[model samples]
Target: MEENNKIFDDEEEELYEHFSLDVDPGQTPMRLDKLLAIHLKKSSRNKIQNAIDSQSVRVNGQVVKSSYKPKPGDRIVVALPKPPREPTEILPENIPLNIVYEDEAVLIVNKDAQMVVHPGFANWDGTLVNALVYHFGQLPTSKNGAIRPGLVHRIDKGTSGLLVIAKTEYAMQHLARQFADHSTERTYYALIWGEPEQDKGTINAKLGRSQKDRRVTEVYEDGGYGREAITHYEVLKRMRYVSLVKCNLETGRTHQIRAHMKYIGHPLFGDATYGGDRILRGNMFSKYKQFVENCFQILPRQALHAKSLGFEHPEKKEWMQFDSELPEDMQTLLEKWEAYVQHV
Candidate 1:
C-alpha cells in the first residue's frame, strides 16, 4: 500500500474524485483493474471491470482496458465524476421527494425550490441525497469509490425542477454519457424581467464563474474563456414588466439558463444574483411598485423551473421524457403578473 501513492484533488459541487496513483518504480506488470482493486478497498473486481468497459479508467490520459498492464512510472487515473462524497458522512433523512417517475433503472424527481440537491458545506443534511439514502437501499456507486450514488445531474438549490437519479451502475454510466454528449432534452420555464426583442432566439455564450463574484456564474459573450453554453428561448407570454419564457438547453453548463438570460438583459424574475430583484420594467407609480412587490412576495426565489426532461432509457433504450406542473409558487406568481399586466 505504501508503494501505491494516491493523489487527491478537490473540486466544487457534486464532483467525483480522480483516483490517481503513480505506479511504483519497482511495480510488477499486472492487469490495471487488478491493481485498482488492490488500492480501492471498498470496490469489487466486477465494478472495476465495468468501469474499464465504460472507458472510464485511463492511463496517462488514455483510456485503457481492464487487461492493460501498467508499467512502472505510469500515472494511472480512474476518472470518476468530480470531488467524491464520503458515504459515511452523509446520513439518511426521511425528507419527502416528489418522485415523478421511477423504475428499476432511474428515479425522476421534481425537486422543490428550497431543497438542496445534495449535502455540502452549510447544507449538511435534509438534502435530496439524504432523502435518497432513506428511500432506497444501496444505490450503486461508481468505481474509484466515488459516491454520489445514483445522482447524475442536478438543478440549482433555488430552482425547482426534474432530476434523474440512476439506480444502477450501468444506468449511471449511460445517463452520464447522455448529459456529457448534450443529447438529453432539458427544458426550463422562467419568468424574466423585460421581454426579449424577438419571440424566439438562441443565446450562444460561454459560461464560467464570474471574475467579480466567484459564487455566481457569468456569461462570456466574446467566447475566449469559459465552456460553451447554448440556450434556445421562446416567449410564452409577455406582460408589460416581465415575460414568461421557455428555455431549451443545448449544453448543460452550470447556470447556463440563468447566466444566458441575464446576458441578454432579461434576468429571471426575483433572481438577486444577476440583478432581477429590482423592477426592470413598468411605471414609476407606487401602485405598480406595490403590485411587483406583491408578486415578489408570492414567489421569493428565482422564477425558474425545470419543467421537462428527456433521455433514452438506460436498459430499455427507448426515449423517456418526464414533465411536471409548475409548483404552486411559480403558478401563483404568473397569475399575479398576468392580472397586474391586464389592469395596469
Candidate 2:
C-alpha cells in the first residue's frame, strides 16, 4: 500500500480528503481513473470516475477527465468527499424539513440551526440526510454509495440556511462541477462581536487546522500552508460594540467565514469554538456583561446564517437563486441589539 497523507479541513465541517501523487518516471500511460483507483486504496474506480466527471480530478494542476492517460512524470491531484458517518441502512425518519423548492432534478432545503446535516459519530439518526431519505425515498448517491443521497453542498450544523440536493446522477455531476469551479453563489449573514475598521473589505488568507486545537481553524500569514480562502464582507449595521455583516465566500473552505472573521478580530457572537463566547467587546460594567449574556442566551449558537444561494439549473441551464429568512433566534437577537442601541 502506498503511504497516504490525509489532511482534514475542520473548517469545511465535512470529511473531504485531498490526495496528491507523482507518477513514477518509468510508468507507462494509464487511464486516470484506474491510476487513482490503484493509488487510493479506500476509493473505487467508480468513485474516481465520478470525481473526474465532476472536474475534481486534476493533472498537472488542470482538471481532466477519467479517459486521460497520465504519462510518466505527471502529477495527479484528486479531492473526494468522505461521508461523515459510516454507511448503514439509512431508514427514512419523518423529520420536518423546510423545503423551499423541489423538482425531479433538484431539491432546495432551508436547514435549521443545531441540526446535523448528515449523521456522524454520536449523531446516528434524525439528521437532514435521514429526513431527506424519508421524504424522497431512495435518492442518488455518489460513486462509492456512502449514503448521503442527493446532497451537493452542506452548511455547518450551527448555521441555518439553504442547500441544494441533486436528484439524478447527471444533476449531481453538474452541480458538483459548479461547486468545484467556485461558480455557485453563496452569501451569509453573521452577527459578530466588535465592528470591523472598514465598512467593506476583502480578507484573503490561507487557512489550516490550528496546531493547538485541530477542531479550530487558524489563518496563515505567510501563505505557505493550508488552502487559499477569500471572504468579502460589508457591514450592514453597527450597534457600537457588535455589528451585523454580510459575507461572500470565494472559496468554500470549512468554517471560512467564522475563521476569517475571528482572524480579523471580529469573531461571530456565540461562536464557542473561536472564542466568541466570552465578552470580547463592550464595557466592564456588570449590566453590560449581563446584557451580553442575555444576547448569548437568545442566540445560543454562532450568529451566522446562510441567507442566500444561487446556481445554474443542471438540466434547464437557467439560473436559479434561493433566499431564506433568518431563523427566529437570530432575528430576536438582532432585535435585542437594536433595542439596546436605542436605549443607550
Q: Which candidate comes out best when scored by lDDT?
A: 2
TM-score of 2: 0.76
Q: After superposition, how far is residue 271 of candidate 2 from its true place, in Å?
A: 0.3
Which pairs clash inside model 1? 15-82, 15-83, 16-81, 16-82, 16-83
Tell me how far candidate 2 lies from the true structure as C-alpha RMSD in angstroms.
Answer: 9.9
In order of listing, the candidates' clash counts read: 5, 3
Instruction: Write down the TM-score for model 1.
Output: 0.75
Query: Candidate 1: how large is its RMSD?
Result: 10.5
User: Looking at candidate 2, what is the lDDT of residue 255?
Assistant: 93
lDDT of 1 by residue, 73-143 (tens): 78776755444345555688888889888899999999999999877657778888889989996887656
Global CA lDDT computed for model 2:
0.86
The C-alpha TM-scores of every prediction are 0.75, 0.76
lDDT of 1 at 163: 94
